[model samples]
Target: MTQAPKADSAALSTDTANADGTADSGAETGTAAPPRPTPIRGYFERPLFDAEAIRGLQRVGVIDVGSNSVRMVVFDGAARSPAYFYNEKLLCGLGRGLAETGLLNPEGRVRALNAINRFSILAEEMDLTSLTMVATAAVREATDGEAFKTEVEMATGIEMRIIDGEEEARLSAQGVLLGWPGARGLVCDIGGSSMELGEVADNTVGRRATSPLGPFRLQQIKGGKKGLKNHIRETLTELRDKVGGDHKALYLVGGSWRALARLDMERRGYPLTVLHEYEMTPKSIRKTIDWLQDQDLSKLRNRTGTSAERMSLVPLATVVLRQLLHVFRPKRVYVSSYGIREGILFEQMPDDLRACDPLIEASRHLEEASARTPGFGRKLFDFLMPLYRNAPPDRMRLIRAACLLHDVNWRAHPDYRSESCFDTATRANLGGMDHKSRVYLGLALMNRYKNPGSNSRLTPLLSLLDPEDIRHANMLGRAMRFGAMLSVKGPNAAAEMRYYPKKEVLELILDPDRQALFGEVAQQRFSALAKSLGVSTKLRVARTAKLEVAKAELANGEAAKAETSS
Candidate 1:
């Protein structure tokens, strides 16, 4: 395969060209060109990506030429939780008739070429030197696939890599791991021409296998539904044998699965619309699949805003899913918005970069970009650590993420900042967050601005969390609210908080020089925090001596007073 040339530094220069396409050289102008400013690194000027890991690249683009659609995605910002800087897709149906004929669909080929051409131009305009293009089952298995690849390169000067079935399965599973570093399951990705099954566990892809069970290929099977059912059953059984059936969860990837997940959400009247990390049970999936058979798909399509092309494949995909549930018997099912494209990005990440939590990285990026004090989130987390001393690792990560994102929404209007924070936490494109974690984080941020009442509009989302989670969220929020009042500089600058849980006392040791910062509002917020913890508030001024010395003196004085009273 021919590799695209590396980006030329001169191509990114500010120098202008003349009308005749000749460069206006400084030598010819008899004047020196001004020096260029240093470029800001990372997304929103945050240095999240290691300079060596990405080879000093700021942005990367990937093109997926699948059986049903062709999509071009340009990823920017943090590599772990990359932002979709530019995304466009066309339902080209490149494998619509591949089952009948050994060649790509004539019309679909034309559309795919046109889409790729436009993507090529867009990449050039965006100053991307190369795009990593991958062609899946449709093109890889077609008779004219290599010829079509040659034509694409001739037309757009972009080489397309035709990956094999196992590679495709591996990449799809890796995509799931990009968002869920600790995911352990069977990843089922259904495209227009084929379906792949890959086992993932312990942050790596295990056994992988591909089958001719795609909807389009199933459509060509004789004997109608009965024949299709038998074919699917046999195919899935073989896949199960090859990949094993020990997986407890099934991670669904690709458009057809996402469409099914969306319909499941609509049927259940789920409040949150965000699709990534949306979980479904085997029973719920069975119910939704049955219900989909009777509903008017056209009306449902319009209501759910699903494209006609994607909806057309849903029925066939649903049949596969039904058989899949029966054969695999997975305890849980999850929909992943990440796919082979994200997997390609993950493939390039270094081991250390891959080890970082996507949610924390994304939250840090948000704080750096929008918070009043960029580094205050870490300080806030430390100040509140006394409250969560025994928190589990999972809970600790969420608390850390909440601290990082606590003040990113301070720019919203005062009346709606709480709601804005809630919406952002619940809907933002942060990976590694499940539905429940989202609500918990959102509630914590909501309480950061104001007390959430029973009649709050976001009350419905509270159902996802139990009483304990809700209580924890409130305490965390009130802790942040009180901590923020301590200093505009940061929480650490104004006071040190010490919670004596056994004594039922929440103590605030104020800095002698910063005593003026403890205003009426600060005191009220402190009281609210103490009330939430069912503890009394204790205020003390720190002496110029060490904190341990002050604590010793106070303890001795209390002990002496108790002895004298006795």
Candidate 2:
């Protein structure tokens, strides 16, 4: 775990360093220098949002003034996967009595104001130029909403934008898209006083509809359980007709939905607790809804670590979700941890940033921040491309992500590094990945350190992938294990690999000058990789210049005639 040496900043800027550590300076030679060779970009290096476009968003603060809670989230770090630099929520229940009385709850208003004031002060201390604040449902519908808005402006010097239900729905769907750029289907966001539905497809939000179907509002309805069920059914029926029912997946947003998902996970003893991409089938949802009817909510809350405030709303949300499932009849359901706060950030992003894959971008950011050699992941992916030349686009993205994240846990103790990598791949706040992909990536990373047959404790999770997936994961891990051994600089600096699947041969051609670098450990790992590929291995040594010439000749459809030594 040695640290890479810091480059001389002056030399790094003024002249390019040759492989032999000599400076290439045109002024010293009295002739123009050759153009620098452009580094090969990996599949994950597709065009991203201009760094300058989001420079100011590095430390953005967003306040979501919802009916049930006032939450302030200060996003920092990578724009695509912005870390929660600061996050705090105060349950104000601002829409508690709004259904009975067309006014904001007096007690809830005070709490909401104090919460906003506290967030404003915190933002000032954090040196944020301004905070993006938006209020949903309750505030927009309450009669005194205007007065509260003015009071908030006067007290905290923050102008709160009270968005209509349609806009709120749109933003919530965008937040889903922020985490799942290719997400298509319906987004259902349930707050305290209102529930909004937005349709999404092709990375854009379509029609949106909102209803007074929130728990707080449902509680005020004259009907008991039976009456509430009827109202929910009718409301969702209308919403389905308005928003269309062709959605394949339903993305649940907001606290109550998350609480329901958590309860569902607890009921099923789900292994991976990360909720962003937690999936539930329609049958499972119905069963969980039925299962909730028999359980003691207080005990369930404790077991699932749900707050009393949020858990109290779960029953009403459950009714809505049950009906939502019935009306939409989606093929799948997923819980999205992202909501209006993340949506606010998504709204500010340029189109290019919106288009970037959240998972790959986040992985790239992790590599840049944590890997010993920041850019080695790209080289590793390129080095391994031959093994996966025929892989579909979807699987290729996961392979690319695995390579980028393969070495980020290098500082962990040897005994726990594999487990740590597995945990990170499964539980880290990575977006755009489903549960199965999480396990696949985890298995690959685990294999990066330890060989196969060592993940006994991870057997339950391993069930997520099939035999072919397991084999592919092992091959990826073994390839990385071999490639990482070649050079601390990177695999490309020491050798290049060629894999012939049909012929069952895996060849490693080493740089003649660096052949000594392929010691015992490297050979053993190379043999393991070959074994994983079920191929025979060949080792060759060629001069660096001759290797380059051979590569060019091969590219030009000419036979390479390099001098090789076994």
Candidate 3:
């Protein structure tokens, strides 16, 4: 299970101290710099971290031993976003035959043991400060679960904490709130052996319950479809009693539920395939379930690229979902890729850290690591404040995040930079934002360099925005383009820009000496900006005694005639 060693000589170069004496990077600071890439799994075979060198980071490993899969996730940092230093999973089906045999599947037990042994070595290699293994219903309820736990512990030298159904529900609900700051909903997490229901209101967990409504358990019930429906109804009634009333949204966790959502995407040709934050109205989800009930599951399996095992469980999940919708009647349904492991991470974070905005923190990290001028983002935001000062709080947040990320991808190929920016905004492992905000931010970045409407490949994504959204995105892009020069020359030393929307005039004011920097290209871009705003342009200088309006060179030329006429 050991991997070959990876040496990051380049990263080592960044660890020296600056002239002022502060550490240049993690090396001199005696902190674990953000992890450098190692082997494919990143965590295995890395050099051990010196205890004193692991500042600002607390690496915690969570080993989830579920009925269907065994996974190990090492979270390297304790920021608002989860940074997976190392992650590996194996489908061991440790609880496959528990219902019939009344014990762990003998073959599955062996496979799981092997996986756990490998995970233990991997965890040690990662220098994981804290590594804990948590097993759910299958291991907690099985007759020989304790004996299996003893065997696993003896083999891996890692104790497994078997969590009961109720705790499982609570942890999964907490996971939802970790990604969504103020989530209010019913969290339904379907596992291989059981399903848990929990209510969350105004950022706190409410009533909760667990049931044997999982596909594996349902298959064990006597009778066919009719019997399964009756059992689901009975279980749902009890679940409703525990977690009563309608919720704003239904947060779905677990592989089977996600698989269903993915299939729903494939069926509807959803442009954004990201499962996290993907939303559905109750009616839409109900329609999908109805459509699934009559379709040939084999075709669906191929169409959605789902495994036969997962496809098989969809029917049972559909039945459970139908009943859940009927009982909860949520306004919307959302799928969260996060779950118990994220819950554990969230529980460990201090209140201040938990309260930080995940998207903004992640954007700031990207800017620090990649931008040529790191602090320029904030400066650019400050300079452009006049343009967006009237924007709503949510809109301003997205604009601020976009500013931070504006130059992070400057290293990309010139022709591909816009596409790269778009992809990163839409597809990065970002949390805490919904799909609409994701698209808005992505489109703004896309329009930053090239004109966004020209790319047909991006048309599908642009469908998420309306005309007003596109107009606003274009305006943001133009503002970024105008302010890009402020990065090269420090923001304070740069010229100022003024806008007169009522008079349909855009003006640039420069210091007399700094006027040299505003050349032909700058004027052309300024003109383009004016054109975008449907206004005329003027150039002026900040003089010793008074602001002087210089004679407009471009405005009198044929260039002005062509631009203005066009």
Candidate 4:
């Protein structure tokens, strides 16, 4: 008999090296085709050829700069799918003891820095181009985070970008799709410091939220409270009622679920302990969760079959799942081997064009997906850029991200999109943020809500902003708001538009016959922003009118040739 030629094992391994659901087959062939890789891997590596290298990245090394753990995972070079990449994790628990203490522990900080240093060296040894170090939750929450971030940069020469929870959740969804193609799954990863949840409607994290309720916090809350279980249940129940239910299939991530599976395996006297190849139903899940919940530290370490290193977190993990189950109530529960780290890796892919900022990126995607017109978004972007030319790079990114996100809510719920954009952009746990960043982006996105004013909370965040940034935001917000107004009035409009500057003033130029909202309130809002930039502005909507006439008078040159020096 002739032997079949080997296809590729590149699809077999991953950072978690979890489950391919065909380990036996994979092992037997040593080089045979994997019947299937996880949907997450395939969903993301679209145009298959574009992602073949994604699986090939097993030799690639990634470091997750998480609040609870600084994990370093490397893939075996031959793995073709992220599902097949073999990787490792280390828990630094940076958020450990930080919630009430109000500071990142020195020990934790040192551990994180050291971990990055080592990971950096490993990445170099591996000669990998795909190395990324990301910080989520704790680092973003820390007061001294910048100092610690700088320490990592100095020590490892890697910039650990602090990201928000929303972006984190989005990326995790991306990675989980590797296994769960096109399924409506509610994915939640409970970390030491935060939990990211995504609702995969139409196989995308179309809506998600990130909260401070990590396993550690959940455990602490359970221990501190009187009616712990009921408290957990009620809190989750209230959360679900308020926010809506998670998908029927609940996907769990982080070490807690992994540990739960191990305990379950021991109870059943399973033959093989390799987790990724493992599967369990709600009956088995509840059984393990119940046992873990009932146990104390002694049992967790000695009898419960959990890693000793993870002993401290088991109680919290149990309560978290317990509460979530009671509240979110999923008919199916699947353990996810992905989280902030994998999410980071998925999003940071060199080819990924998403802005990576939740509010901005989601907003931009929403804007594009929702809009029937093309130039509307570009016109908004072009109109807004000049106003922010003087803003600090950091704030500019946040505000720009908000602007991109502002028009996103137009299609599904136009009336409520401003609020939605504001909520998603601000509250979405996108990593790499400080409170100020969230507040400001939230405020900017919500410009549509309650007229702009100095007395509002978002005002402070905006107050410190470069005067020009305020002007830019104001100008762009007005134009975007107006574009939505006009887009519905029925056809006959310019698709692309821009505003050029003249002596600190801006000239608004739109496509022929574009509608600029007339009458009181809109003009008042528009004028306030224009006035802030020292530019006396007037809207010119008719196309037959010449721009050169305005430009030559106001700028002494064509708006195109005008230089913005000051």
Candidate 5:
């Protein structure tokens, strides 16, 4: 759950104290020097207070407890994608004897407990902002569920939830949907304890069902075919009727089945294999399932696909995969590289925030709008930031991405742009969204400029979304429009756009009798937005002693190319 034992440890070479927390980095500070990473002068509660100090970013760790195994993931703060820095999984089958027995065995419980303890220590030492731990079917169904949870929390200081079956299915689908673009079909999450079947249509989720035959349960049923076969048959019969014929394109998740597929591919020496984009035909899948069915537990242990700890659960996993294939008869099975961890990320977000796809619905809309007006979208966003003095720093970046993509609709046909842009962003495979949620985002984008009597195709779309998201789309849309109007001549064709704030009215130092051509309409729109958005709009043109703009290297950015070469 934790990333590392140490924080800060900035790759800095020197340090110096100031009246504020800002420090100069060097071997000498023109005075006696302290260590490089020490808190600066006059800073109380250095980590939390220090008004002028460098604030640290927060990280969240997501842990998943499954029937076959448990895993932990840490997303790094510094990386561009906030890439994964630590990922570890252990297979401790509390579910192994669960079919015959009602609870976890003594040995299995000890092993699982030890793993949780280690994770807890790491989380503490690494200083994770928070950790979300969820126990799935194995632990949920165990008679000693509450006791097991108590032991984990007491031992590791990490509280866990034994989430219900419906919650599990919803989260599993959400996690997969977070990074899945244009994914509309069924999600079949086959775990050690149960099979969760869900649907993502137009980015909305409906009909979540958790089937009885988990890998462990199915294996037991297969082992005692004459006795437990009817149970397995009945479960599959119910699942087939629920899935019906049309929604059989499967988005496969959970470890047992993924491990099986990975092992089969590794054995066959298929060089190109990436789990998220991993593909397999029904024929290939059937052959792999058959091979797995033929093997005994010992053979499975010796096989390449089996992890050291998951050796015992092979019999159960194979049976579940075979039974599902036989009963549901899906056309294709697509492997998912994400599940509960991602779902937990979605859960942590505010409820209204979850109604739409965050990245796709928001970021794409603004980026496209900037492209149309040949405006300084980024600069305009920076200028407008004074309005968000109390907003979270992270939200600042989100607002920026939204502004950049605001004009994406301009690329499509003008009349249907709002609707089309809404559709494109949600369904275009943008990261961090499902199809229906993406639809909601698209709808929000189209309705950003909602006006009276301008609610035909857009009204039904708006009905499916959260009201706040619609408001956000408008705020973002206004900023984009303001930025565009500033470019009256269109993309440097001429300098018709002029900016002058009411507080600092235009004062030219040109010839006393001369006046430059400044468009009145553009100026009026600029003033309106400045008042509306509460931004200080500024522009000045005067004869100065210096004739050309200077090129200087910035503290963070490099100098202009002409200056660099010189």
Candidate 6:
């Protein structure tokens, strides 16, 4: 496989921070510059990839020619996480007949080749200096796979890397780790012709095993239910030996599994529709898979809004999933929207690039692209630091992220900014966040715009948070609201905050020149900040240094005269 020049996965968004402390309105680059890693109190920080890696080739692209879909994804800039600049997929079942004929489907092959040619032209038009094409499963198993690879290269001037099952499993597992840096469990990646299982822990890939358990393969099994069961059980024996029947988590990768999870979401009326990181307990998944066995899949297709072709494979995939849960008894099953493309992206990233914090880099990217003042996010954070003086390291990072993103959504319609802000934080393809932390950030952003009413639709996600978390979110929001308004003249113009915990007083000391800008609305926001802090508020004009300097000079003159007279 050819390695593309590793593009630093920094924020690709062209939101440049200007010298005047304002965000420049450049074309939105899908990437952002990451925040410098400062060693937070009581926490260790790792350096990020050097800027030189991303300097020449800021954007990279990959074409994934898979069994079920032939797609092209352009990742802009670089960072530990993927920032998609362009993505397109064509569902051509290139592996549709591989099980029966041991050859790529004739019609599907034509469609895939045409798609590849078009993708090649598009990549050329886009001038993707670092583009790589990878083919999986179907191509690997097909009788004329090498000839097909040759044809593709001759026609498109691009050599496709046909990855074998083991490499495929390794890349899929790496994708899981890319999204979940702390993932410690099994990764089940289902494809058209095969399913690959691998173990990952402590940020490293572990044992890997591949099986002919894909839905397409199951469709061609000699036996029906019994045979399918026997085949799955027999095939997974090696996997069982390697991974054991322990209750570790299982990270699901593949379109079919995500479709199944989406169906479950529809069946349960789940509020958040974001698929990546969507988790289900073994019992819940078992129930859903069992229930799927009886439901009218046609109607289920309509309800869940999944394609018929995709739904057709659900039952087969469900059987495999059921057996997976029963055999592995995983504690939880998480779906990853990222797979080979993301893994390809991850493979190119330098170690420092892989270590950068995903959430902060993303927020900083948004701030650079959309905020009225880019640098003010840091100012706002510093201004409110007194409020979070004792915040734990994790809490402090979240706060800093919230501050950076405080104004990124202002471009949203005034009526929808709050909800939009919440959705952006919770649903964006951010890394290193759990469901609870995602909701917490969303709620904080929601409150940053306006108070969340009791009956807000967002209340369902609140189940993940307690009162203290909500209170803390509100404090950050209120502080952001005040700081935002105060920093309209840039961060330097914002008033300094002084907190006296014993006195229970929160003071806003304004520069005299900036006093007029502090008006009724500002006062109201300051009061809200004080209320959130459970403290009394004081608004004072700071004394000028010139007066103190003159007084000291006069005293010095008097002292000199006294000495001379003596």
TM-score top scorer? 1
RMSD of model 1, in Å?
A: 13.5
lDDT of 3 at 359: 68
Quote model 5's TM-score.
0.52
- Sliding window of 10 residues with minimal summed lDDT for model 4: 20-29
The list of candidate 3 runs beyond 4 A from truth reads 1-58, 489-492, 543-566
The TM-score values for the models, in the order shown, are: 0.88, 0.87, 0.84, 0.50, 0.52, 0.85
List the global CA lDDT of all models: 0.78, 0.76, 0.70, 0.53, 0.52, 0.73
Ranking of all predicted structures according to lDDT, beginning with the best and ending with the worst: 1, 2, 6, 3, 4, 5
**lDDT value for candidate 2?**
0.76
**1-566: candidate 6 lDDT, tens digit per residue:** 22253332221111110000000000001222111233322211211322566544466778888888889988776666567778888889998978889999899899999999998888888878578788888999999888899999999878788877777787778777776666777888898888888787766677777788888888888887899888887777667896566637787888888888888777677667777777777777777887887889999888877888888888889888888877788777777777767776677666655656666766777776789876567767777888888888678878988988898898899888999999888877666666667777888888888997888878887766778888888888888887888746443354678898789999987777667778898889989888988999887877867434534554575466457546
Ranking by TM-score: 1, 2, 6, 3, 5, 4
For candidate 4, write residues 1-566 as lDDT tens digits. Answer: 11111221121111211111111100110111111212232111122212455444445455677766677765333121232243555677788877777678779888777777777876777666455565778888888888888888777766566667776666666555433333365777777788777666443456667776776555556446456676666666655653469467676667766777667766665433444323455666678777655656566457645567576676667667767876777766655554544444444333332212222333344444455642244444444565556656565556555545555555546566565655554444232333334445555666644345666533434433456555555544554454444433211233323334555555555444334434465456556556645567755664455633433343442233234221
Listed per model in order, the count of residue pairs whose N, CA or C atoms clash below 3 Å is 0, 0, 0, 37, 21, 13
Ranked by TM-score, the better of candidates 2 and 4 is 2
Using TM-score as the yardstick, the better of models 1 and 6 is 1
| The best candidate in terms of lDDT | 1
What tens-digit string does per-residue lDDT give for candidate 2 at 304-368? Answer: 88899999898888888888888889877877888777776675666666667676777887887
Candidate 1 lDDT tens digits, 469-511: 8999999999999887788766656778999999999999887
Per-residue lDDT value at 140 in model 3:
92
Query: If both were scored by lDDT, which would come out higher, candidate 5 or candidate 6?
Result: 6
**Per-residue CA lDDT of candidate 5, range 1-566, in tens?**
43322221120101100000000011100121111111122111111211122123356676677787777776543111123556777777777778788887667688888887887777777788657677888898888877999998787766687877777777777665544433566777777778787776544456677876776766556547555656766787787676564664566776665666665565455432234434455667667767766657565556554566555555566656666667767666666666666665544433333333334233433343346642234445544454455655334444554445556656677777666765554444344332223433454355433321355544543443356655555555554454454433321222212334444432222211122333575566555545544555655543332211211112122234235335
lDDT of 3 at 76: 68
- In terms of lDDT, model 4 sits at 0.53
